[model samples]
Target: MAAVFLKLDRFALRQFNTAKYAGTRIFFDPDTFESKVNEYYGERHALETEFGDRPALVQGYAPFCRHLFMPNFTGAKVSVQRITAENESLLRTRYEARRPNELPVLVRFFPSEALGGESALPVARYLDVILYSREQCLKEAQAMGEEPPLEDAPWRIISIKAQDEPYETPMQPITIMRNSLIGEGGSGVPLCRKKYAEAVAYWRERAIIT
Candidate 1:
């Protein structure tokens, strides 16, 4: 199977809470999701202004939803792997590196023409967090009114070296859909990460997640 990996800094980690100890995983209703996207790119841009350029932490269209459109409370499917030696040195550096090569280049996913809150849409698409097209994203953003542009959005550079494997399966074709649901739930009781095996066993016994 083809898979795409995403590296998140501490800020993105906070929103996803992929790590059980990171605390609460945010509940994004379109609006909050857009806000967080804007926030992330904004800070990344700041880091870029200081440093000349660097490679992006994540590559390929990501933020995939093998389960949650964003992710759920326990962050199932989003496992935390060890900081690879290959990617470690670049991940660890001063807040504002004196040398340009010390940090990675921060960049925005979309163009300046996107305008208004329209910017967040492209960022979402870049992460594969959004399955819709540029047109669809713009439509949604239009309804939301004018907001900060992608370059202008206030958002981060957190010390982190986390890996998120999105596609356990091959990529699927994208189509236009009217509405969708994204959120939290795992039966009546919300099982913690520790009970993962038990939950899987229960589901397998019933063929729920087979």
Candidate 2:
């Protein structure tokens, strides 16, 4: 059976989990979830090579891009909420003493009406603030263990675990890599996890995973 997912923005949903789906206003659209997963995974050979030597083919998918509208390769976007997480979601972590530039992204919440193909705000357990440039990243981000220079990509995502007191400064960092989610996509309570396990198992049974 196709599992249910809130019919919200897919890029922002890299932080997907049940706590973010708390309210009744969100739609559980299996079709949309399936659709996004389709783009993210692409064809079987594409997955094996990670779309190797064919950046344009992979960049054609919105899941692997930087643009808010869709389809580009500068980077990808993710969203996390600023609250206590209920389960083992991305909210269970924090960032370094670094912060994003003051430039704001879209405001997110569960929408009341059908987005109908319109983009809707996103939700997650923690907040992933994106810094767009190497210069800005140098100014705002704290260096960790001589990590490589910031990529030429526009979306530098930092997953920050936050508090409720209206959000203070000096954000910390912990990573939740998107490529790592290829086959590890369950983040919910027992029932939700069960359904997710069922879906993954179904695909595996068809030789999608070895």
Candidate 3:
């Protein structure tokens, strides 16, 4: 089985939801998706000759999920279902509970990128939820050692405020994807953190502003 990783940045989740439904402004480029894909997979020989050796690039779920959620509601919802299935049985139950009114949707299963195999990865899964209070959010973050920012802070911080809080209430799961870190070069060094940081930096530099 492939290992999957989950990344839940509270700041990014807030930004995603706000921009998604409230007409808030967030910076992202649709065309960068292709640029990003090329960066991860490596440049074409023709493009490389034209542009010279570009920076070693990496890509990950955060930005990809953001792009995917914009116009693809069904896909986003299904992704949420997969993640929810892992923990709360209620989501699956509720989904099934409404099968009379809600029709089943097809979900695509792509091979794990980290494992480079045809089998699905089962490491970490992604989820986005909104809580009722900043206090609650802060509490969860503190438990996870991911405290939110003070009112004056400039950078956005996402934290698991409370581990014991109910998964229900105002919170609703958004999208989920399996994550994993796989080592390259047989040295047995874990490369997930390095790749994740590289991917984050790539987007940060592009001013893609996530």
Candidate 4:
């Protein structure tokens, strides 16, 4: 099975387990979660609309581009979520034990710190706090490396892992628009353009535009 890339946005993630001062926030309307899976199948644009302004979601574009542009690269199904530490642990354990033949697991992290100031609150600041806390967590994890509880999972950590290598920022407009048109045939081109126009108009109206 292809790997399922779990993409989490800042608004969906909670604060670090041990970081009392940092908290995460979601960017989409909370109500969207009530019927995400169902609506996603019927109207894929709904998902793009939900992710449009999120910088974290935008970051996925670079990896996606590599997958699309590179030869012989297998594609992956992208899924989004907002989960707590306990939920993450539970999911990881289940996937590892089951080793389901259908799909590979690729968990991506979206820190609130990356959301920047385009959002309503101090998203970037909160992310910085979370990062600081995460650094501490990593140090502890490294120290406990050989301990029974410190065993690491086998999943490939990409799309969200902290790395020193330089990466070109993904092109948000092209990715969202192009992905929206997938499977729609030629008619989607005009429709995508219209949607882009509407997005521009909406941004102009809010003046809170991306």
Order candidates by lDDT, high to low.
Answer: 2, 1, 3, 4
Task: Tell me the TM-score of model 1.
Answer: 0.24
Which one wins by lDDT: 1 or 4? 1
lDDT of each: 0.27, 0.27, 0.26, 0.25
What would the per-residue lDDT of candidate 1 be over residues 1-210, giving only the tens digit for each residue? 211122222223444432222212233343444555445444554666788544222332222211112222222332121233442332321122112322322211211122222222112112323222233233333433423123211112221111243322221111001112111100012223434454344322221000
lDDT of 2 by residue, 34-122 (tens): 35433443443364577453331222112322211212111221222233233213212222111132222222232223222113423
Better-scoring candidate (TM-score), 1 or 4: 1
Better of 2 and 4 by lDDT: 2
TM-score of each: 0.24, 0.19, 0.20, 0.18
- Kindly indicate the candidate among 1 and 2 with the higher TM-score: 1
Residue 63 local lDDT, model 3: 27
Higher lDDT: candidate 1 or 3?
Answer: 1
Angstrom error of the Cα, residue 196, model 4: value is 2.1
For residues 1-210, write the lDDT of model 4, one tens digit per residue: 222222222212331122211213223333332133223222433444686532322222222222101111111111122344533432321111112222322223333223332233222211110111222223323443421222132111112211111233222233235434423211022235655565554332221111
Q: What order do candidates take by TM-score, descending?
A: 1, 3, 2, 4
The true-versus-predicted C-alpha distance at residue 18 of model 2, in Å, is: 5.8
lDDT (10s digit) by residue, model 3, range 1-210: 211112233343433323222112223342332233223223333444677753222122332221111122111211111222233322212111111222333222211222232123222122222212334335434544544644422112232111112231121111111122111101122335555455444332221100
